[model samples]
Target: MDVLDFDLSDREFWAKPMVERRDAFDRLRARDTPAFFAEPVVDFAPQGPGYYALVKHADILEASRNPEVFSSGSGGATNIIDMPGEFAEYFGSMINMDDPRHARLRRIVSRAFTPKMIKQFEADVNTAAAKIVDDLLDAGPGCDFVAQVAARLPLKIICDMMGIAERDYQFVYDRSNVILGGFDPEYTGGDVSQVVPRLLNAGAELQQLVQDLASYRAEHPTNDLTSSLVNANIDGERLTLQELGSFFILLVVAGNETTRNAISYGLRLLTNNPDQRALWLEDIEGRAPGAVEEIVRLGSPVNFMRRKVTRDFEMNGHLYREEEKVVMFYWAANRDRSVFEDPDRFDITRSPNPHVGFGGPGPHFCLGAHLARREITVMFRELLRRVPGIEGGKPDRLYSSFINGIKRLECTF
Candidate 1:
């Protein structure tokens, strides 16, 4: 048997076009149940353990569903070596937890997004969508869609929800961009050695800002989600100060990054597949939902998540021992030939699209999924209605393996 060294964390590997990466994963999946690889050491982080890249749809789903065997709490989700205890604890959200701890954090956080909050958020999303379209209209044609359009609605909505001031929106936006895409020169710049330190610094800045906001909210409560979070408790349980910081970091990075990338990809994908774009434009109301799902499926932002095996397990006659790291390649699973018919085709009406664009079938499934979907649907509907002639040029992609992001995408209307 030939050993395929598949490194999920390799930046250069991820920089390859989606078609190329998909083909590589397909070949790996055929050969190895879970292909073993020496995990790429990111920045100066020491290589901790070699991992098996979970390439198959079923295997990724199995790991996600059975958190007991594939536990996130055992370590942080990043494929890199261990972070300092304090930093790891402060950065890992409920996504990096299991069982009672995960349940506890999730329950408390759920209170922040009550029905009333969600209803208000939907209304806000619609308003933001309209404003975004209006801005595009005013700016005329040939703008970087990622900057002028796709990135706006979600970031604005998240900032508004968190009660961040308009001035701070840019601050949060810059830091979030750096936090996720710091490895990319478009965001970080300068020496490669400075990237990780700069990312850490940006993270620290975000944590401090959130902490200050949380502190103020705790004292002078308001209707914002930040206030709700600061004051929220469920079953006599509440998030500790550190937990709040971690959750805020997760929300800032995950909330803004995923939706923006999805929207950016949606435009690019639609541009590439005009037939499907026309299909969506014909019935915006009926097709928007499916289109959003398909966009997310194809985008597959947050490429992979790592889990530490707690006990020995067997899948496809391959043994996974305790203490082993397994990187569930969500990107690969999303394109699994066994799952979606015509997996590569970006169809607007892809029904029964069970894409794990959001962390497969698991307890740690994206909390802001409903809101993200709403934002995408509303934004695209507005765009298609107002700027039906909008066409996307080639995208300058983000240079990280973890996030499938378009840093800049030029478009003309």
Candidate 2:
């Protein structure tokens, strides 16, 4: 296919083979200026000016750093089009905001992710990973690795952190799938027109779940994040029910989906690269840090994030007009030939790996990155030790431009 043939805003573009996707991005990055694409028309929102596809690492890094100029809050960072006001109750979190509002929310949420909390979650991650592997062993092989293994760890971690009941796990999981499911027929029932309602419904359900929990936690606080959020901190700051609920939706969706997809892709990477797997197996503990970073770099699971231009600005010798939008393609940036050596190869020991899997360096850089790295490290450590010979079959990929997800991958050991 010609370089000009692929349109980033086209849904069918995401459904193409991985190689084609890579080549299209390569062509984009090879261009002197970022390619512009018309926004995908959605049922819920009016079409606006198109966005520049920032496929190169340098462009993404610069755009991420200069958040003042490239605003995430103008429309929404998660979507290319401006989000309707009703969607704010579910989708508007710190990620979609700018300072001082963004700064305030970050300060409140950062209080909950202290070292003590992360250290505690570390233990929980290990225990959960062990149980998942045990259950996988008992169930034998030929099961969906995504549902049985990859999806469970982050789901349990996030739900447990929020003090969500075990009974509500599947409820939360299904809702999250819809929120990030993109245009997938399996999740949206194959109707593009219904996508907005499905997303809003999912968001409302998740918000209600957390709000109910927040009400309970307000009266009787626990050690979980919900308790910390609902109750006042040392500074006497607290998140209102709406704030808590929206934050929970963001946490669950971002925390759960990104890590889950990373793990699934990690398995696929290992299965395809036995040498890297062997290298990791030789010293699982010692190699975990590098392996985890390599996996995240190659996975680039969260895909692209949208930012609107706040003013007329020139970046990397290209002019960006005021109010124009730009989509930072993390997956494409992660594989930029200028930055990553042998860009496509998955090398576990690739030192100085500056991939933007967790997103580029900025105020919006992933808050749960530390915990995500820990979870990936612990989960893989367990898999390598116990299910070392396990392998993932062809992935049933999620049909979405925003998230590089694997809905299901059959596994064997």
Candidate 3:
């Protein structure tokens, strides 16, 4: 097979049209081995060894399953470049850590993210989704679907769970954008050089906000997740101020952004596939489970995550050397021909869909996957029920490799 001309690490590549991007990944997936690309140069960190782009489904699944060999902590799983020590202060939650530390944090946070806990928030999720649609209906069409609808539900739910005030919702939203802004100039103020400082500032601001809230929750404990995390459980385990702050940052950034983008993409998908929309509208609740999964499969919002090779290991007929990095392109893997039939088609009932949009099956699978699914399902249910003819115009896509975000999509009924 001929090699693709695009560079996965080139910031410009992410800004390319979706068709071109899809074609590039298709070529990568068709290759015999994972394609290697040089690390993107950034002022924040020195140049490092290039990484293999694991665009195939088998490669991503195998890599995710072997966390010990493909470490999240060696440098950091979130970035292709090793995370600087300063960056870790705010950005280094369990997502960037390995066993023991990662296990401990997951164990503690898992308590709050249990199915029962998420069920407790189900009414809030439903109520919030309904309110958002009500506002969207009042505003009528031509409003930005992202800002008016997609972004609101997740942001409100995450803040409410954290006991954050409504006044600070924008504050949290802006910072989370900056934190995961990737190379987007809109969030970075058109200065690539300033990205690191902007990210650090954003992280610092969010951390401080959470720390202050945590301090209050320490004494005035409530049923909120913040209180549950800050105070001790029956096992007497609690997050340190640093851990609490970083985890909160992760929660708001990852949880808010990923679900928000998924909903935005979900709307876009439904609009593009009206037949699927018709099928879904026929039995809203009955079809929600499958429709939501299919949306996530195609949307693949979180995109790629980087993992470092911890030792010399062979997997799926390829060898990864010690300390080498591998970037698992979830977006590409979700479209791999070997996995899903008619990969690009947006069928609302695509079954056996093992898309790793929420990271692959492993200890590192998304903690809030259940909550995210709930948010997406409830938001769509409310939209389909009230605004069944709602359709999204062309999406103003986020120019970022990490997030498949719709910055502003016009909606019309």
Best by lDDT: 2
lDDT of 3 at 16: 93
- Candidate 2's residue-wise lDDT over 260-349, tens digit each? 999999999999999999999999999899999999999999899999998999999999999999999999999999999998999999
lDDT by residue for model 1 over 23-68, one digit each (tens)? 7888877875666777666656567778888878889888888888
Of 1 and 2, the candidate ahead on lDDT is 2
Q: List the residue pairs that clash in candidate 2.
A: none
Cα displacement (angstroms), candidate 2, residue 342, comes to 0.1
For model 2, the stretches where C-alpha displacement exceeds 4 angstroms are: 1-3, 234-236
Off by over 4 Å in 1: 1-6, 114-116
Assess every candidate by TM-score: 0.95, 0.98, 0.98
* Ordering by TM-score: 3, 2, 1
Ten contiguous residues with the weakest lDDT in model 1? 78-87
TM-score of decoy 3? 0.98
> 1-413, model 3: which lDDT tens digit per residue?
66568898898999999999999998888888878899989887899989999999999999999998999998888888987899899989999999988998999888878899999999999999999988998999899999999999999999999999999999999999998888888988998889899999999999999999999989999989899888866466678999999999999988999999999999989999999999999999999999999999899998889998878999999889998999999999999999899999998788888999999989999999999999999999999999999999999999888888889999998
Better of 1 and 3 by lDDT: 3
lDDT of each: 0.83, 0.92, 0.91
Q: lDDT order of candidates, best first?
A: 2, 3, 1
